[model samples]
Target: MAKSATLYRMATDEHICPFGLKSKDLLKRKGYELDDNLLTSREETDAFKNKHDVKTTPQTFIDNERIGGYDELRSYFNKSEAGQQGTTYTPVLAIFAVTLLMAFAFSYASNFALLSLNTAELFVALTMGVLAIQKLRDLFSFTNSFITYDLLAMKVVRYAYVYPFLEAFVSIGMIAALPAYTVAPISLFIGGVGAVSVIKAVYIDKRELKCACVGGDSNVPLGFVSLTENLFMIGAGVWMFIK
Candidate 1:
């Protein structure tokens, strides 16, 4: 006989528990015959919670054993919590994807051209802005990770804190089509230093480490992607100087 499970979850008109849906999907995927008990009103949800002596909804039971919530169910099945740990390119890929779309959108809106030099420039600038925003979200955390591999950050700790702001400034200046004199120097300096740091840490020393490109808490590995980011800034700086 197929395994059987019971799930009590919230499904109200005003609010639906996302975790509840996740639990239901997981049970179905795991080949469990699920008894999906929906608590459709606040009173019903509260009653269910009170009766079970649980603090939250989306409770599950497998073979009559209580499996607390969505996270608990995942743990019971020996599944890793989503995006909680491990090396991932998700953040970086997401930034790139969004910036690419923005570049195309802006280019088309302004000049009716989807592909142009301006599009390329916009893509790079927007990427810098987004990446800088991620770092700025938690400057302390970002600097802690950045100092591990960045030579400038190690020698002058304050530089790590200033780095994200510099990126944001350059991004804005480039997008605004400001004179190269104002932005190119900063871009060149940061990008040059970043490229050297990444090379020494990853290529020369061969030390495996996480990147602060996305943020301090991120699991993005330090290597090619990081190097490419620096190279992009360098190229943009040079382009600005020439154009």
Candidate 2:
């Protein structure tokens, strides 16, 4: 016999519970025969809530046992919490993938070549630029998490705030093909400090922590990926200086 589940979710003219949709989708994917009960009015939703003695909508039941909300449902199924929770590489991988594709597109458009030195340069520059934007979105949060592992940020404190801006500036200079003298030093300084910090924190110290590379709110772990980012910056700096 197929498994069975029941879901009570709110769907009003003014509002629709997103967790409800997620629960419904998860049920289908898990091969559950779901009885989707929608509370279409404020009164109806509140009544259901009060009856069940629960605080939230999107309540799911398995085998007639209450399974709580979306998070609870995920827990029951041994699924990771979606978004900025626990360790994940989705954000960093996504940024790298998109930036590489963009680099290819730009290279093909400008020089009629999909792969070139320019493409490599553009990829690094674009990655830096996008990563900076992520940091800038939540400067306070980023700095708080950043200082936990970044050597320069830990000592200076203010460097945490300045770091994103520096990345942005370096990215702009690289993309604009500005004089190497103007951009290379800053890149080298930040990248060198970052690389050392990651090595000390993850390798030497053997501390496991979330990386602030993608942003302060990120769930990316501090390890090889973080080290790779710093290495890329270092490589970009040296390449720019030499060529």
Candidate 3:
């Protein structure tokens, strides 16, 4: 027990260089102060990282709480009511889900949710009207992103979106009762097109293109980050159809 306590304290004394604001902020926010734990040596910190699965040296460990990575930290922070309630997109997400449900109904049953074709068409038109309003709301909600400074200092794209715009059309087509010949070929073509656009942007433009899909960031240029984000998005759209 004595050795364990000694090793833990020593490991946290900043590790390798004994610097960086992350460690300072972690300690100060807990009200413990730094000198309380700064005397521990560097060798022990490296040893602790090896002994445990920890990749970070100045990370927090409160009680038996999880020593988390990025994803875990996100889940923890966003799980609180304070974290969840402050979003301007709740209503939008609800409407989007409703739209998806309507789409799914139209796709699977060949009729929009228990209604006759003519009747369903009218209802669907009304739903699309609602969706148009939601889209405007979504644009407004994300408008402030233009001025926000990302800690990652992510770059914006200069030119792109010719392909993803097409893919978005195909994704809509996939859930509709378009001619089978038209449906399969167009979807595959759109997916291939999006893939090419992403690769070219990443390898050539070399900046992350933001407006390709999520219109959130003002269309960033093609780059590693943009390529990664686009691939993930395309992957997500593909994964929706395990059926």
Tens digits of lDDT, candidate 1, 112-215? 57878889999999999999999999999999999999999999999999999999999999999999999999999999999999999999999999999999
- TM-score of candidate 3 versus the correct structure, residues matched by position: 0.27
| Pick by TM-score: 1 or 2, better one | 2
Best by lDDT: 1
Per-prediction tally of clashes: 0, 0, 11
* Per-residue lDDT of model 3, residues 1-243, tens digit only: 111111123334344334324444444554543342332556666666676678754443444454443333334445433234322444444544676566566546754345454333333333434533432444533333311222111233211223333344444444454444543454454344445655655555563434322334333333443333335334433433432
lDDT comparing candidate 1 with the true structure: 0.94
Off by over 4 Å in 2: 1-6, 27-36, 60-68, 71-85
Candidate 3 residues lying further than 4 Å off, grouped into runs, are 1-169, 203-205, 216-243
Q: For residue 43, what is the lDDT in candidate 1?
A: 98
The runs of at least 3 residues in candidate 1 whose Cα sits more than 4 Å from the true structure, single-residue gaps closed, are: 1-5, 9-18, 25-58, 62-68, 71-81
- Candidate 2 residue pairs in clash (backbone atoms < 3 Å): none
Give the clashing residue pairs of candidate 1, or none.
none
TM-score between model 2 and native: 0.85
**Residue-pair clashes, model 3:** 11
